[model samples]
Target chain A: MALLNKDGSRLDGRGVTDLRPLKITAGVLNRAAGSCLIEWGRNKVLAAVYGPHEVFPKHLTNPRRALINARYIMAPFSSQEEHGRSGPNRRSIEISKVARHVFENVVFTERFPKTMIDVHMEVLQSDGGTRVSAITAASVALADAGIPMRDLVCGVSVGRVDGKLVVDLDKYEDNLGESDVPVVISPRTKELLLFQLDGLLSKKEVSEGLDMIFEAANVIREKQVQALADKFKDVDSGDLQ
Target chain B: MILEEIKEDYIKELLKQKKRIDGRALDAYREIKITKDFIQNAEGSAIAEVGGTKVLAGVKFDIMTPFADRPDEGVVMFGSEFSPIAHPDFNAGPPDENSIELARVVDRGIRSAESIDVKSLFLEEGKVLGVFVDLYILDHSGNLIDTAGLAAMSALKNTKIPKVEDGKIIRNEFTGKLKLVREVAVTTFEKIDGVIIADANSEEEVASEGRMSLSTSSDGFVCSAQKSGKAGFSKQELMDLIDLSSEKSKELLRHI
Candidate 1:
């Protein structure tokens, strides 16, 4: 079946450039230094930050700067699969590595030397675009922890479905889509923090997809800021700056 | 010289002068040597050496029931083990993030390019043949991803699909060469001192602030890409790197 309606609307009645409904809340975990819960469409991801504390095994520590440790975990019942296993399996491991890399670029690790800061993202439910949702929530969790950062990072997946480019694909489109390109950016600086391509796409198509991601990221960035502001409403807004 | 110059600083200084620690040009790769049939017991095998790094890839086949979701499709799995013998940093344990990432990157390149005709391996409604590319890092000087990728691709090129008789295995007998659609190779660049250097060695890898690896297929398109380390690239910089990778991968595929 064609993914689009005769009226140029997506299967979900969204325009090509429209994003899924998103909601983000900070300080969702009391035990952790900071935490965030993000619900985007049918996905729910929670990100937590702990430490800037002593290192384990000792050797992994860097004397000049802190080590950024990030991991992504998917609960066994988190997905639509036939009871997906609680996995840090090869796929999750690879995603965790890239998630850690993006955070490493934005965190001010120099401010806390000889320490390790752990950022963990747990996926409660995943429909599609879990990686982007995880990292987006992780950014808010870091801010809630009072960690200094260059900017709030945002990410979105752009897809070519039914030979038409679209923003923020749902699980249905993701499976039948011709291409999936996930691009992440540090919204303040416009630096690409994460880039991955997983379909047969020409350079031009991928290039155009990047532009779509850039525009979609603004919406995510705004929500991240709003969530943080709401979390710290009791204090002066100047304190946030 | 700055008083606080560390090992990374020294390498970056050389990079600023358009010279690497080993005097290679900014965009030049280390010499690559591939040894095919390195393991006779396996269905296919190759050892790829790039500078001081060595990755051995072996291909083996097994018969299994297809996955529940995709019953008609055959499976191609890539596994990488960073043996302690490779480097001091590696330990004897289950696969870590770096090793997992390496295997996945190589797997993506091959799968994205459709290098193998998986459909041909289907035997029955539920039964299928599984191709496994097992990579061992005998030495880890640096740039293990490219070395592993080359080794896997070369091993695939040398593979022969084992003949099946009534859905039973024939180990020593031949069933003709495996049908390969195209070759894929990876090109990696590390940014140091704000300059991108290709095929970095151990010292250069340590000094680098960011790293990007692009996998290009023989049909002239980037099949996969990964950006790592603690830095980001502008869109223009990323595009330029992709162009460079597409060009460099041609030379690599020719060697296979």
Candidate 2:
């Protein structure tokens, strides 16, 4: 079968199960209550949190819990191929739903009733794992906004390329790779909120992919927490200058 | 003109006590944030955040045959478009007149100041050109002229010529800096309540009846000027602003 590479190698110079370089930053936006920009290899995502305030439209309000409204946008010039439009698209809408679901379960929505929190994410560049990167960045932005949450949500994508499993595929690998599995889990509770597979994968391959993604999520979650600590650790009042 | 009335009221306040909502004096400008070489893919790029306004510009080089008339010199083109994604008011389509005016004014400032060495851009006399400058406006808060001009200069200064090997585009491993000829700085003055203020924001821009954007090089010379207000300034006021722009240019060019 041509499923595996002749030399047993992925398209990129990566091993069977290796994650891409990951970096996350919080409080990048000045106006937003909370904001962050995360870079996973060449992919870059910026997430911002706006509310937890009173709901604007009466019809959209829920008295028992807060509502989560999220939108994902990709910049027009970000890709080599022309991105369709200047605004959100079908794929962005799907990612928005998945991202909203992941954060809705983790955030303490019951604490702020009759209010809606707007989380908007823009992908400046896209490799694979944009959804997971959104989830990872959204949670940090929420925390940066001073919103209470049960635990930090960590997102990671694992995929099978050339019959071998890989973690956090970059754009080059993602577009040409065979299959991908993205998992968003609460690292503290170990509860998976979203599981999605794109392209194709066998049942056994899916299981192995999830295991590698979750293990890597733990390492990423620690880094996410440390970034928060480092941002607010010991800045004097005069440091704003 | 939903904001016209609000702007007029604010202008009145500025005339009374020379104060702005952000608390800058009549002639004072907001804090400026200048960052260079931000984008990795482009040959050179810069992000200049003045107050709440942000502009990111990048320079990309492509080999092209020189124009028939200007065979001895390379070509330089500038474009500015406000993305609708950045604001609700920005609409889709080709750039409106406002956007065109902004690009031309900034382009004139650079050209008049001769910040770029056009002669050096010609790789082979009457053959191919070595450089091109592409200015992009990522966001528009207010006073786009100054922000765009600063970003264009920063991006050009950070640019490096690519290495051409055997008529093929090979990566340039050797590193060197571009040779900048002059430094030009733009100062946008909004005429509010019969007074002039430096670096107006979106709100202040709407409040003022007119605006005067001036660009000056580091050598105390005026490069370009744009007047867009209904009300005209007196001769003394015009001269005073030119002097102010020259001093401001010196201060800003040093930081670059």
Candidate 3:
């Protein structure tokens, strides 16, 4: 059950700062205004964007700005654990709330006042860092939908396993690690959109871990940009490059 | 929060002058009061009050099959209800996002700090004691996270594991105190008009742009944290908040 090998490599042979295989595909669904699929490590997440439409129930409307509804749900068969009932459980509800907040800052809702934008994230498979993975995909989906954004959001994490600091933890490391800090960052704005910590860590570890988080975030952001760039290429955007 | 009653302009203006609506300094918290073990029926109970926010926490136990991944560890579940009477924004229905987040945040603090020796609660091969901490928001003036956390931690601190006979617990009989490995507390800070203030009241909460809650254990380590709202903090601002929470936790731990 040792998380690390004697040479300091992870169980999967990743370096301390290495991320799992990252693959993001934009515009996977035709019906959604925007959509994307991301495969991070062992996590398979699909995100779709809808609306900028009239608010339902008529009571949840915000006059000054459009409402952003972010819903994160894990499929019943997504995890290795016992089959769970589908829909918003307490964990997903919390994640949805935080994810919703992330889009609130990213999107310029004031332009489309008295409307609602729906961002749906479905976890087809999960290992760990699902929330971060979901949010990262949702951000790309929002852009694909042509929603105006202040900046793109990037999600990443850092953790301590076997008394060593590492980036982009896997399921095994997360479940057994001493601590994990998942963060969502606005690369251009220099703002931390989402920050959540699980387990205990000293001040020094926290500060040091954040450094790793931000660095890993930059790498993830590049992949996101590349994904979107490829999507544009598919659309026949005239390239002068 | 009652949006109509929120004094966004007034609170922001006051904070700019380094003064709070309640006349406290930037780092000051509203008066906190914790009353423990007042509910006699439950194994443990406490009511935490911060300014006008009032939350009650009660601890109960049951025997359940442990998760397959960790058969030797007990379980601690946190539930919360934001009663319609607690705040105007609350509704009488299933728990909403705010309530769920509150319970989880407090739960993370306690669970991460190892407040309960999960292994010690292992009863047999497949069964373990499950501790349930139910938090009821009786009133809302703001800072519910801190209040609920106080109540839960205090309730668990005073809990007594009931003695079991033939796999059934006696009504009033008890073993000893539930051993808490460490104490945990959450300190929430709000950024209003670019000013970072601690323990925001209901009005300030409505006016704030962003919020972050840091949970620290008694041993000076941050056990858990959650950053919420639309706005965000810079690297330095977050670092400062982490340090501030660490220092503020010492004060809250004293009350528990």
Candidate 4:
């Protein structure tokens, strides 16, 4: 089946540059110091922040800066047919490492020396593009926790479907698509935090995908800020719950 | 683990007056939330939350050689991880006793109840499908066993077996949902100052003397039961606890 029709419209009835519907909610959990829920199309992700507290195991702690421990987990029932394993599988472990790297650049980790800032991203439901969404949610969660940051991070994936470059490929498109480029950037400084590419792509296609993702990141950054604002709106009005 | 004397005494005193630290009745459970299909990569997955406690269960199926003893039946293996991020007390290492106990309890319940129809999973005499249920403890408020059990059962119920042809599994082609023979639910009660409380939080769990987990099937039969902690339960107390568990299981099974 053609992923995109002759008129440049994709299978999900979106234009080549169109992104999926996005929803972001902050401070959804009571246990975590800060939390955010992000729903990008069929993907549902929750990000929780704990610490800036003492780092356990002691030896892993850094002397000059705090550490960012980021974990990304996909729930067993989040997919269509197979149940995911619960622990840090190879994929999750790698995502955690990369996500931690992304946050270290945005978060002011040096302020809390020898401590750790733990960010947990749980994918409650997924339909592709979870890794990027997880980063988006995690950044909001850190902000929700009132952590100082140089800039908020936002991410999106752009890919090629049926020889047509598209933004925010869904589950169906991700499977059949030829190339996917995921990018995470600091909206304020426009500094790249994460950049990864998979599948085959030409130089021109890579540039086009990167341009789309960079633009999409700005839009997502706005939503992230708004979500945090909504959560603290009551506090701003002097009505503390 | 060191229990704060003041906190322990506070819980004990509250139970005496038929009150809980969290303002729940002795038999009342915390809020229970179950979300299914949480992972897109797994065949079946669910997240079960009991108050602040959260457990994620994912079911994955793989084709493998059946055990020599049970060649005609499929296999179900249960694994659990108590991640350090879940709680401060949980350290990162190999599976500990608590995790092992939790996995065994959850495994026994599903196995004894025959929740999944393993016979139908038999693809051939030597080759059968293996169902792997992995439970991830994300947040640990208390009562992880019950939450993990609930999550596992819900995930299994949501599982869809993929199509297999000539010993090769088709990822995109699903034959149908896994055949479930019965629905199972687990209810845990902690004995605090001789009073039984359902769904104990971390504070209440520390003060409790004994803990009992009862797994009940929809057919109104107690499939599995496990008791732990330093204290013991009387015969009368056990019977009462089982009744309480049976009633609570009905409420939990509704989520499935």
TM-score of each candidate's B chain against the true B chain = 0.96, 0.91, 0.97, 0.97
Q: Give the 10-residue window scoring lowest on summed lDDT in candidate 1 chain B.
A: B1-10
Residue B23, candidate 4: alpha-carbon lDDT = 90
For model 4, report DockQ.
Answer: 0.01
lDDT tens readout by residue for model 1, B94-162:
998899889988888888888898888888999999999999999988899999999999999999888
lDDT, residue B202, model 1: 85
lDDT ranking from best candidate downward: 3, 1, 4, 2
**Candidate 4's residue-wise lDDT over A88-130, tens digit each?**
6655765675677787777788899999999999999999899
Stretches of candidate 2 off by over 4 Å are A1-241, B1-7, B171-175
Q: How accurate is candidate 1 locally (lDDT)?
A: 0.87
Best by DockQ: 3
The predicted structure with the larger lDDT, 1 or 4, is: 1
- Candidate 2, clashing residue pairs? B210-B229
All candidates: TM-score of chain A: 0.96, 0.90, 0.96, 0.95
Report lDDT per candidate: 0.87, 0.73, 0.90, 0.83
Model 3 C-alpha lDDT per residue in residues A67-170, reported as the tens digit of each score: 99899999999997779788878999999999999999989999999999999999999999999999999999999899999988989888899999899998
Q: Count steric clashes of candidate 1.
A: 0
Q: For model 3, which pairs clash?
A: none
On lDDT, the stronger of 2 and 3 is 3
How many residue pairs clash per model?
0, 1, 0, 22
Which pairs, if any, clash in model 1? none
